[model samples]
Target chain A: MSLDASQFEAFSASELAFLAEDELITILPRQNLSRMDFKGWVQPALRALRRSEVPLWLAVILKRQDRCTIIYPNWLDATYLKTVLEAEGRDSASFAALPYMWQELSDTILAEAAEDCQGSVAEIMRTLQELKELRLNKLRQGVLVNNDSHLRMDGIGSAELNLVKPILSKTMRTLQTVKDAQEVETV
Target chain B: MNLDLESIINSVGRRGTRTRAEYTTAPAQRLKQWWVAERMAPHLLEYQLDLLNEVITNCRSLRDYIEETSLTLLDEAAVESLGEETLRDVKIKLLLVETELERAKFVARAYKRTRMAKIDLLPYYYLQQQESQSGIMSKDEWVYCHHRTELEASSYYKGFLNAFPTELQGLTDEDGHISMIETPDMDKPVVVRVNTDIGTLKIGSEEVELVKNGVYLLRFSAVSDYLEFVDIL
Candidate 1:
C-alpha cells in the first residue's frame, strides 16, 4: 500500500520498530527528549521527513530524515552549518553526528589540559567544572544530552569513552539522529 | 601566439555576416533523401539493438551490487553516503541512451513516407474520358441531334470534339454525355450522357435534353468499379 502523508502524524515507536524489523527502514526520531527549546528544532525537522517522498527502502532504513531535525537542522541548512563546522575546525566531509562536533571542541580546547594538568586539584576541579557546565547548558537548551537521558553507550571501550566523555556527557543527544537512521534501515 | 592585433582587425573586417531563415527540414528526412530505404532500415535496427545492450549492462551492475552486499557489512550509514550518488549517475546515463532511441524512431518514420510516394494512381480517369467522347447509343433505332440557329451557334457546336488521353479515362463531355454510335436502324440520333471527371460531353445527334448535373454511381457498383471520379455538375 502507498503511504499517505496523513499517516505520518501518529506513528508509534512500536509501529516504527516493527517497520524497521520487517522492511529494514525506520524514520522515527531516536530520542524524543524535551529539554530546553529542542522541540522547536524537532518539530520542523520531523516535518521535513513527513514531506519527503523517498522510496520505502530509503524511508525505512535511512531514518536520518527524522532524527536530523532534532539534532542537526542548523547543520542541514547550507550556510549556518558551514559556519558551525568551520568554527569547530571540521569540514563538510568530516562532519558526522554531534559527537564529532564535540570531539572537535574538546581537541581544540580541553584535551591537552586533561593530560597536562593532572593531579592538580585546582586544575582537576576546573576541568570537571567546565565539562559539567557544558553538559548542563546543553541539557537546558535541549541541544544535547548528558548521562541523564538514560541511553546506554555500548560497544565503546574505556579509551573511546575517555575520548568521548566531554562531548557525550553534554552533546550525546545528537547520536539519536544516527540511531534513528540505522533503525530505519534495519527494518 | 604572437602580437598581431592590426592584422587580426583587418581580417575580421574582411569577413561579413550573412543571415538566413531559421526553419529547416528535419535531419531524419534529410537522411532518407541521402540514403535509400534499404540502407536506412539496417541503421535503425542497429541503433535499437545498441540501446537495449546499454540498458541491460546498467541493470546487471545494479543487481550485482544489491545481491553481494549485506545489511551489516554495508549498513545504513554507509549506504546513506553513497546511494544518492549512484542514483544520480544512473539517471544521466538513461537520458543519453533514450535520446538515441528517439532519433532512430524519427528516421524510421521518414523511411515509410519515402516508400509510399513511389506508387501509381491514375487508371480509372482515362476510362471515363473515353466514354464521354463517344457516347453510348441504345440498341433501339433512335438518334440524338441538337438543332442550332445562327443566333445560338457556339464554338462547341462548330468543331469535332477531342478525345481524352488514356490517363484521363474518367473524362466526361460538357452536357454529361458520353459516347454515341449509329442507331440500330436509321432513326433520330440519341445522345448518351455519362457523369465522369469534370465537365460532360455530348455525342451523336445533339438533340437530346442537355443534363447540366452529374449522376452519382450506386454505392455497391462504385465500390466494385473503384475507378469512378466525382466532380461538381
Candidate 2:
C-alpha cells in the first residue's frame, strides 16, 4: 500500500487497524516490557521525525497507557543545540548545554521519584545515571566543537550543572535511605 | 425517522463516488461483517439528518439552564454582598466560573474532533477490507496495536523527549557509529551493545574506549524494542 500524504489522511478506526498491522512497533510483550518504564521513549521518536523547522508541541494519547508519555531524547543528541546556535548565527559549540539541560531534567525527576519508591528505585536510578552518563560522554566525545578551544568550555560551562547538583544530592539521599531501610528490614 | 430525512439520508453518498454499479450491486460480504452498518444504514442516515434537530433542542435547553442559573446566582450574590469590595469579589469569582465553563466547552470541542477522527477512519478501513483477499473484520474487531508500535518506536520516542526532555542527551556527532566519551573517575561506565546482547560496567581502572556513553541508552531502546544487546570489546 503505497499511499500519498493525502491518501493517508482521514483514517477511520478500521483504517487505523490496517495501518497498525503494517506500522506497529514490535517490542517485548507487555509482561517482560512491564519491568521497564517505557514512557520515556517518546521524544527520540519525535526528534527523529522532526522535519518542521519550527518545533511542534506534541499532545500524545496512548491507547494502552493511561498517562500521556512524552519522550525527550534531547539528552541523546546535541543537534538541537547546534540548531539553536546556527539559528542565532553564533559559533554553536557555546550552547552544547541544550541536550544536557534535558538530561538534567530527567535525572532530577527520577531522583525525586526514587526517594519513596522501593521496588523500582534501583531501576529508575540506573536509568537516570545512564542519562547523565550519556550526556557526559556526548560532551567529552566533542562532536561539534571543531577545535580544542571550543572543547575548553566543555564540562565547565553547562547550563545544566546547577540542576544536576541538586538531582545528584537527592539521588544520594534516596539511595542512602533505601539502603538504611533494607538494613533495618534485615535486622 | 420521517420520510423527508430518510430521502436525504439515502442521498448523501450519491454526490461522492457512489456509481450506478455500486448502488445496484448487493454487498454480500458487508452483510456478514457489518450487519449493523447495513441494517442500521437507513436508521443511521435518519439520525444524521435529524442530528441538527437534536442539537438545536440541546442548545435551547442549555441556554435556558444557563440563563436560569446565572440569574439565580446573580440575585443571591447581589442580596448577600454588603460592601462594594465584596460585590466586586463576587463578580470576579463569577467571571472565573464563566471562564471555566468556556474552557470546558473548548475541551468538548476537542473531544468531538477526536470522535470525528475515529468516524472518518471507518470508511478507509471498509474500502481496504473490501479489496482484501481475506474477509473483512467488524468495526469492533479492528485493532491499531501494530500501528501503535511503529508510532511508539518513531513518534512516541520524540513525544517522550519533548515532554520529559532528557531521553536523548549529549550527542554532538552523527557519523553512523556510536561514540563514547570518557570521563575520568566516573565508575559506572556501563557498555551495553545492541544486536550483541551484552552489558558490561567498568568496575576497576580497566578503561574501555566507548563509541559514546549513549550506547547504554540505545541499548535500553533496543531492549525496549525487544532486541538483543551484545557487548563488544
Candidate 3:
C-alpha cells in the first residue's frame, strides 16, 4: 500500500496537531535573526529578548534549539481555565468559545514547553481533563436527544469534534433515514 | 426536487473557505481545503491540478536551495573561513527550511496519495466517468487510471478469461442489467458543515435548515451540488 493508511480516516491526532501548529503564537527569542519567507507566509525578523509572533511549529523548532521560549497563551493559565471550566458547566447547550485548536495547542505547549510556563502543570492538566469530560458528556447527551437531521457543533473544539466524527456520522445517518421512512409511512 | 436543485445541479462545487478569518485563500489554505475534502469524500473529487503544480514547483526549488547551501557549508575550506555568527545563521536557516519543507511535502504527498487510493480501488469506473465528466482526474491521473484497467483486462484474459465461454468473457456490463463496474456509493452518509446560509435543504423527507456555520449530517448525493457552501468533515 503506497498510500498512507491514515488518510482513509478523519484527521489523526498527530495530523490535527500539525494543523494546530500553524496557528500563530508568541515566543521570546534568545538570539536575533532576520526575516525569513516560508513560501506560504513570512515570519518577521526576531531580536534578542524581544517577543515575536510566529507559527507554533517554528516556535517549537526554536525552543528545541535553546534559542527561544514559548509564551503560554492566556487561556492555558490555571485561573483562566477555571473560569472556562465554570463556563462549561454553566452552559450545557453550547461549548465555551475556546480557540478552535485549543486542545491541541494547549497540549503541545504543556508537553513541549512546560518549563517556561508560570503555574502548576498538574493543575492545568486536571482542569483540562474536567473540561473535556464535561463537553464530551454534553455531546453524548446532544446526540441521544438530537433526533434531528443535523448536529449542532458550533464552538466545538477540533479535537473533540474529530473524536465523535465516525460514530456521530454513522448514528445520525441511520436515525435520519429511519426517521424519514417512518414519516413517509405515517403520511 | 424544486428551484434550488435545478439551478445548482450543473454548478460545480468549490469547498468554502473561512471568509471570517481571511478573504484571500493562500496556497496553504487551498491545499488544506482540497486535502480535507478529498480525504473525507467517499469518491474522487475534482483533482487540484493547479494548486499541486504551484506547491510542487515551490518545494522543488526549495529542495534545490537546501541541497546547494548544505553542500557549500559541508566544504571545510568555506566553513573554516566564515565567522561564528554567519555559520550559526546559515545553520538555523537550514533547519527552518528543512522543517517547513517536511510539512509542505506531507501535504502534497498526502493529497495526491489520497486520490490515488480511490483511483486504484476501481479504476474502470472513473475511466467510464471521463467520457461524461473529465475534470475529476488530472491528465497524469487519467493515464494512471487507463493503465490500471488495461493491466487488469490483460491479466484477466491471460489467467482464466481466455478459457471462459466467448459470451461470458466480457468484463464490463453490456446488457444494461447487472452492473459489472462498481461506482461509489453516493448515498453514504457524510458529516458536513454548512458555512453559508442556504436556507432549507430537503434531505430525504426532512427539510434541513442550513443556517450559517451550522453543521449537518447528510447523504453525499443530497448535498453534492451545494458543496461550495458545505465542507465535508
i-RMS, each model, one decimal: 39.9, 26.6, 13.3
How high a TM-score does candidate 3 get? Answer: 0.85
Per-residue alpha-carbon lDDT of candidate 2 for residues B1-233, written as tens digits (9 for 90 to 100): 46445434543433212322331221221111122121211111111213323333433444454565468556866556547644543343344334323433432333233333332434333334335633333232234422433454466556564565453532222345653322111111112333442344332222222232233211112222222233210
**What TM-score, computed on C-alpha atoms, does each candidate reach?**
0.15, 0.21, 0.85
Order the candidates by TM-score, highest first. 3, 2, 1
lDDT of 3 by residue, B1-233 (tens): 55335323322222111221331254655787788888877788887788888778768777987998899899999998888898998899899988878888888888888888989877878998988998989988999999888899999999999998898888876587777888886766666778888998777656878888766666777778887998777
**A73 in model 2: Cα distance from truth in Å?**
25
**Candidate 3 or 1, higher TM-score:** 3
- Tens-place lDDT digits, model 2, residues A65-98: 2212222233322444334434323433333334
Q: Which stretches of candidate 3 lie over 4 Å from their true place?
A: A2-7, A145-148, A176-187, B1-26, B162-164
Please estimate how well model 1 matches the true structure, expressed as its whole-model Cα lDDT. 0.28
Q: Is candidate 1 or candidate 2 better by TM-score?
A: 2
| CAPRI classification of candidate 1 | incorrect
lDDT of 1 at A2: 23
* lDDT per model vs. reference: 0.28, 0.30, 0.78
**lDDT value, residue A20 of candidate 2:** 22
Which candidate wins on TM-score? Answer: 3
Q: Which one wins on DockQ? A: 3
